[model samples]
Target chain A: ELKVEQNPLFLSMQEGKNYTIYCNYSTTSDRLYWYRQDPGKSLESLFVLLSNGAVKQEGRLMASLDTKARLSTLHITAAVHDLSATYFCAVVYAGNMLTFGGGTRLMVKP
Target chain B: NAGVTQTPKFRILKIGQSMTLQCTQDMNHNYMYWYRQDPGMGLKLIYYSVGAGITDKGEVPNGYNVSRSTTEDFPLRLELAAPSQTSVYFCASSPQGLTETQYFGPGTRLLVL
Candidate 1:
């Protein structure tokens, strides 16, 4: 069974702070994806990491993948209240299906 | 394009009732999937189709059935609803490769009585 785990399931940070959300999978996979979901809303695609050491950035957020370690991280820089949301990482297998992590809920306070 | 669209944003069903959750994507994606999300658990794949006329089971497939009769539509069927089946259902579509990004719908919230 393929399992994806995210660390610091609940995060509370203040504005201008920096934090990283970690996602580790139990299997080897070359594809990883990050998504954000606000309360009662659909998921919004954040980043897609296709290879080892692949890094993608969007606004104040950056995501990196380490395929060798089967790990992915979403780094938040100078976070703001508007950036508060639940972030998820998914591991993709050869079958072209995604197994999602439990998700990290970030609460950024002013 | 509407990306991925799911109908009946919300619904309440009585036990043993049957209903279908409709999903369609205009991106011409060849892969469609259905997932269920609980309160704190991650999304679990229920069913998926590689293309039209090809459907397969996923991690959690019991009590659920899916059919992909066309490239753009994939509908999930709940034969007999139950309390445990009440969750947010999301339909997603992606292109045919493993590197493709899956586009998700707004999701359907179902509550079983």
Candidate 2:
């Protein structure tokens, strides 16, 4: 059983600020993914970090993985209202199966 | 390509009731998965299928069943509904390669009373 822990489960930040959400896993797997979900909506894939030093950025969001430490991160830059959603990090368990972390609810206020 | 689609966007059922949640994807993905998301919690994998006629249980599978009969469709059956099963259900699919970038369906909100 893989245990995944995320910090600061609820984040309230102002627009134009920056913050990072951390995901720590209990296993040795290089496949880590980030996803975002709006209220009452399905999840949308953000980034897939496949290597220890892999970093991917889209729009104002960036995700990185440090497989050696079993950790991954999702960073928000210049936060906007549209980024107010729950973000989750998941690691592949086996053969395309994934185990997800407790999401971080982000609220960006102007 | 419609990506992934699920039927019955919302449903309310009583205890011991049964229903089958339908999922289909036009991407012709080889791997399809079923997940349930409770309020304020991460999505938990209920079941997954690698290909037609192949299926496996995931992290949480009790009281849920799934089948894959074609490359595009995977249906999950709930035989005995319980309050614990009340949650939003999502269906996702991914290619067989290494990336495993999953595309998700809108979701089905089920409430067991």
Candidate 3:
């Protein structure tokens, strides 16, 4: 079974601060995905890291994958109130199945 | 494109009652998936379909069933709803598979009493 774990399940940061959410997986998988979900809303894809050392960024969020370590990180730079949301990391295994982390809920205070 | 859509934004069902969650995609995706998100937890895959007439179980398949009769429609059926089944259900579709980004629906909030 593939297990995915994320750190700092709940984070409260002031606006303009920076933070990184770590996602660790138990199995070897090269494909990692980051998604964000607002309160009472469906998830939205943030980034897809397909290989080791793969990094993708959008706006204030960036995600990186290290396949060898079975780890992925989602970094939030200069956070804003609008960036407050629960973020999740998922590892792709067994061809088409995704195992997701518990998720990191971020609350940005203005 | 309307992307992926799910019906019944919210529903409340008593124990043992069954219901079907309807999902549709307009992007003509080959892969569709059903996932359930429990309170304060990540999503657990219930079922998935690679294409019309091809379906498979996912990580959490118990008490849930799915059918993909057409390329654009994937419906998830809950048999004998239980309190443990109360969660938000999301439907997603992807052009290819996990290698590609999956578009998600708004999700259906189901509460089993």
Candidate 4:
């Protein structure tokens, strides 16, 4: 069974601050995905890190994957109130099946 | 393109009652998936389908069933509703491969009493 763990399950940060959410997996997988879900909404894809050393960024969020270490990180740079949401990291295994982390709920205070 | 769509934005069901959650995709995706999100938890995959007439179970697939009769429609059926099944259900679709991004529906909030 593939297990994924995320740190700081609940984070309250002031606007303009920076933080990083770590996602650690138990198995070896090359594909990791980052997704964001607002309250009462479905998930929105943030980034897809396909290989080791793969990094992708959009706006204030950036995600990186290190396959050898079975880890992925989602970094928030200069956070804003609009960026407040629940973020999740999922590791793909068993032929397209995904195992997701518990998730990080971020609350940005203005 | 409307992307992925699910019916019944919200529903309340008593124990032992059954219901079917409808999902459709307009992008002609080959892969569709059903996931459930509980309070303060990540989404867990219940089932998935790679294409029409092909269905498979995922991480959590005990109380639910799914069918993909057509390329654009994948509906999830709950046999006997229970309080444990109360959660928000999301349907998602991907074009072809694992590397492709999955587009998610708005989600259906189901409350089983």
lDDT of 3 by residue, B14-38 (tens): 9999999999999999999999999
> What is candidate 2's lDDT per residue for B43-110, written digit by digit as tens?
99999998999999999999999889899999999998999999999999988833768899999999
Each candidate's fnat, in order?
Answer: 0.66, 0.76, 0.85, 0.73
Q: Rank the candidates by TM-score, best first.
A: 3, 4, 2, 1
Model 3 — TM-score against the truth? 0.98
Question: What tens-digit string does per-residue lDDT give for candidate 1 at B1-113?
Answer: 87999989999999999999999999999988999999877898999999999998988999999999899999999999999999999998888755766789999999999
How much native contact recovery, as a fraction, does model 2 achieve?
Answer: 0.76
Please give, as one word, the docking class of candidate 2. medium
Clashing pairs in 4: none
Runs in model 4 lying further than 4 Å from the true structure: none
TM-score of 1: 0.96
Error of 1 at B107 (Å): 0.8
| By lDDT: ranked, best first | 3, 4, 1, 2
| Superposed Cα deviation of residue B42, candidate 2 (Å) | 0.2
TM-scores, all models, native as reference: 0.96, 0.97, 0.98, 0.97
DockQ of 3: 0.91
* Top-TM-score candidate index: 3
Worst 10 residues of 2 chain A by lDDT: A91-100
Model 2 residue A16 lDDT score: 100
**Ten-residue segment with the worst summed lDDT in candidate 1 chain A?**
A90-99
**What is candidate 4's lDDT per residue for B68-107, written digit by digit as tens?**
9999999999998999999999999999857989899999
